[model samples]
Target: MALVKIIGCGNPLAGDDGVGLKVIEELKRWGLPPGVRLISAGLPGLTILDLMRGADQVIIVDAVEAGQKPGTVIHCKETDLARVTFRSLSLHNIGIAEALSLGRLVEPEAFPRRLDIVGVQIAEITWGKADLSPLVAAALPLAVHTVYNILKGGGPYA
Candidate 1:
């Protein structure tokens, strides 16, 4: 059986930047499949490495500012991460891309065989803000569905 891990990363205080954490919270209520694990990996950084290690497959959900309209949910493979620029509101030395790359190098056997990212476009990342923007809030269900599809063996972006 494959170990599928869903890790959501973001800062809960940074407005729309917290969409990842919100999605994770929503998923908890819906329940999860067998062999699947969910993690609220806030602010990522080096913590993602630990969260992903030993997983056969991994899905990371986070906010990105890639010049798209706010609330747009984008699905991408691990290889595609290099093309998309992630938005960071925290002071992390290493972002998701760097962390995954280092993880693969440090533990080839433990590194995930498959990896995907569910990114939501953000309109703002203002400090002291705890709620998501209306646009992003609306996209949460779609993001959750997308992650569900992937975990059910529907494949990436199904």
Candidate 2:
């Protein structure tokens, strides 16, 4: 089991909603740190608990509809994620907030001690959409850097 786990959640077919997956794809080129595991968890609901088990810390990357400007990146800690109410009309799966809550309830000891969410404000999410909006696409590098910093011991969760 890794010490740190990075899970990217999204559906690649849903326009800008795929930012998390896209970031994971990009990260594949850079060698990851030791004791770090990367997972591209597409639309994972309760399965997030399984993926996070045994890790000391977890960083989740996902597209969020927080009504912020397109391409905005919001960093949320575990408490912040717990407070967020994920109400969306899209046909996406259960959100990170709910997943983490359930994980904590089910297995507190196996749950990660530190959880962070790097949410990129999404412009649109639709079925059969293959590409991201320009704004959301522009935020990809920023999200990647943010995650890298976290892994490097210099981000908010650090």
Candidate 3:
């Protein structure tokens, strides 16, 4: 099992909501430590529970309707994730947050040792295969850096 897992969850067809997928694409170039794994959900929301099982730590990236600037990025730990207020990822029937919560209640021992969420503020969530908006696109680098730092056990949010 990997020491760390990074899962990008979002829908490519939903405009800026695809930022997580975009981050995953770039991260593939950077590679990871021997005990690290990277996976893209492409809207595999609740499935996150299974992906994170047995992992020491998990970092999830997704686009969220935080009502901030288009490119704004927000960091949240497991505790924060529980208190988060988002209806759901438009592409997902049930979201990661709900799934994680359910997993904790149903089989706490199967949960990851650590869980974190890095949400990027979405501008356009309209239905289409359009690329991310320029604002959200601009935040990609920072988001990448944040993820790197988090995985390495060194970051502002870590």
Candidate 4:
């Protein structure tokens, strides 16, 4: 059974870092396909592995600092994450890449069969910032659509 899980990771307290949560919010309102679970890993940090457990396919939406323009949608496979060890992912102290690497060491079989990462390039990650930047806000629809296409459409907004 292919259990597709969309894991949105971020903290609303940080500026553009919260884009992942925003994507999750909009996806929920759009009435996504049944059986496709949406998990908000709001600053999950080290607990990310637990959120993704048992998922046959996992799509992680987060904010990344790729030196690209704000609102840029970056798509990547799980393996690609390790290549950029210096670049941070999701504005966390320990990035998603590090978490996944550590998880693989602890429980190799617990990993998903397939994994994809859809990231929104961040402008800034200031604490106490509760809103997205103008450019990031404008790119919400595209972010939503990117996630939808990853699902390969099972129904509306799919």
Which tens-of-lDDT digit does each residue in 1-158 have in candidate 1?
Answer: 78899998888998988999999999999898898888998886988888888889999998887778999888878777666665443435677777877787887787788898888989888788999999999999999999987776665441
What tens digits encode model 4's per-residue C-alpha lDDT throughout 74-148?
Answer: 766777775542244635767888888899899989988877788888888788999999888888899888888
Worst ten in a row by lDDT for model 4: 82-91
Question: Distance from true position, residue 15, model 3, in Å?
Answer: 0.7
* Cα lDDT tens digits for candidate 2, 52-71: 88889998888888777888
Candidate number with the higher lDDT (3 or 4): 4
**Superposed Cα deviation of residue 133, candidate 2 (Å):** 0.6
List TM-scores for all candidates, in order. 0.90, 0.89, 0.90, 0.88
Model 2 lDDT at residue 61: 86
Candidates ranked by TM-score: 1, 3, 2, 4
How far in Å is the alpha carbon of 97 misplaced in model 3? 1.3
Off by over 4 Å in 3: 82-88, 155-158
lDDT of 3 by residue, 35-134 (tens): 8788998777567788887798889899988667788887778677646554346667777777778878998998777787888888888678669998
TM-score of candidate 1 to 2 decimals: 0.90
